[model samples]
Target: MNAELEARRVERESSRVISAHARSWQLVSALRVEDFDVAHLGRADQVILDMEDAIDDRLKQQARDHVLEWFAGGGKAWVRVNDVTTPFWSDDLSALAGSPGVLGVMLAKTESAEQVSVTHHRLGGHVPVIPLVESALGIEEATSIARAPGAHRLAFGSGDYRKDTGTANEAVAMAYPRTRLVLASRIGGLTGPIDGPTVGSVHSLLREQSEDAVVLGMTGKLCLDHEQPAVINEEFSPSPADVAWAVDFLEKFEAGGRVIRDGSDKPRLARAELITRRASYFHVDPR
Candidate 1:
């Protein structure tokens, strides 16, 4: 990275951070041609017109044309194209380039910061990108990818990753990768990375995973089921009850309660502030 390019990278990274803070979206729902209309009913924070995993290889061209029609008609959404190395990638890019409907591109199986730059250049304009990092190598380079010039943020492809690493999809099995992406986003000054989905519409499991993401400092999640969005949004956000608790704790701490004024006062204050900050995302006007 030359000085000029480094400067440009910094500028774009700043844009990404600003863009993330200004956006209140929390859930990303993947959709195919069959589900396009339902997706527009607004059940999700963002819709990914999936051309990679969701569609069969034989139907790739059909999916591309359908998506192109949707774009040309002025509909807007992110398109999750195949990886850069695949044949489908160029075709997906060709269909997506310069379309007003493209909110951004979600580059599937993103492994390197350089790959993000290539996707950005090929897009022919300054479209924000969310790189879906899945492989072990991708997770290792997560910080670089998160800070890459065109990347808006990162998304963990948990299922594929589990397959790659031969690990179960259990939370403990997936913890390192999840934590890596989340910390990388924070380090890069981007909004928290989007965590992967919980399958089978299991509300209990969904809530558990979503809460885990929140505890790990992630605010957004990729949702497969439509109902998963509400769960993700709720779990990531500090509810009114949480706000109340934070306020009461702060007040008592200010009044010098021994427990509140204990050695942990500083961390308590920071926690309260973080609770309020998370609450603010949902327009939670504190009373």
Candidate 2:
């Protein structure tokens, strides 16, 4: 019975490794684009528009226009709209929903799933909604928020979250929140959560910050500048070494039939962990 069970596990692991390899290849082969060059970035798989303080109708319209152009150029564009509770909520949604280029709307300061649902109803289901959790309340309500209709992804709002929690802008301080968002996103069956941008100066610091976020299970990092998208892409996208290791690990596990030791370690690798590792390769760095 034990041997039979081990065979099943091995089979499952092999299948997982194949899937991971295919996914990794897709991610590495995928195109990437920068922020300001929305038209150029539109060629990539995803684009993010940060509309933090553009409250006026004109600026909002301009933002919507740029996003629409990006979509027209054949890229998936997601706009980070102002907080729903703010005065700009109605205008932002109304403007974006009417734009043909906007594929998704990311709601900032989302405290509950109800907020997402409300926004979806207001937009009349034109685009998917991603909830950005930036406060203690948002973190606590993450699960419900992820389950909300139109909620396709969960994002961490690092700067606002740090200010709200009074936590230092360091990896240790942000770890808990990052993990919580990842857990909630997974439970709610949303796309894996994206880590907040590193509000630092040095390139090395930013790289380290992104690595830390990756360790905490974030699939991607947010960016404010175009240069940042490249930096982010380098970090989130797995290196050639990572691909080699995953491939080798799976090969060894498969050879052993029912039970395999990973690099002499007694325990076998979990299927989920293997998938996560493979998924990491596809995560583009938004430098």
- On TM-score, the candidate that comes out on top is 1
Candidate 2 C-alpha error for residue 157, in Å: 0.6
lDDT digits (tens) for residues 1-287 of candidate 1: 24664465344334332335322232332335556645544446566777888667788898888888876654566788899999999988888888888888889999999989889888984988899999999999999999988889888898889889998877788789989998899888888888887878679998888877777777687776566666766676777887987878877777877645467878878889888776665656555
lDDT of 1: 0.76
Per-residue lDDT of 1-287 in model 2, one digit per residue for the tens?
A: 25654465344433331211211101110122233343222222355566654336446556555555655554444577878777777877877666666657778899988899989888887578878899999998998998999887788888889889899988888989999998998899865688776655578987998889878877766665435656766676666665565556566766875447346444335542454464554542222
**Clashes per prediction?**
0, 9
TM-score of 2: 0.73
Could you estimate the TM-score for every candidate?
A: 0.83, 0.73
**How does candidate 2 score on lDDT?**
0.65
- Candidate 2 residue 37 Cα shift, in angstroms, is 3.6
Worst 10 residues of 2 by lDDT: 21-30
What does the lDDT read for residue 135 in candidate 1? 94
Q: Pairs clashing in candidate 1?
A: none
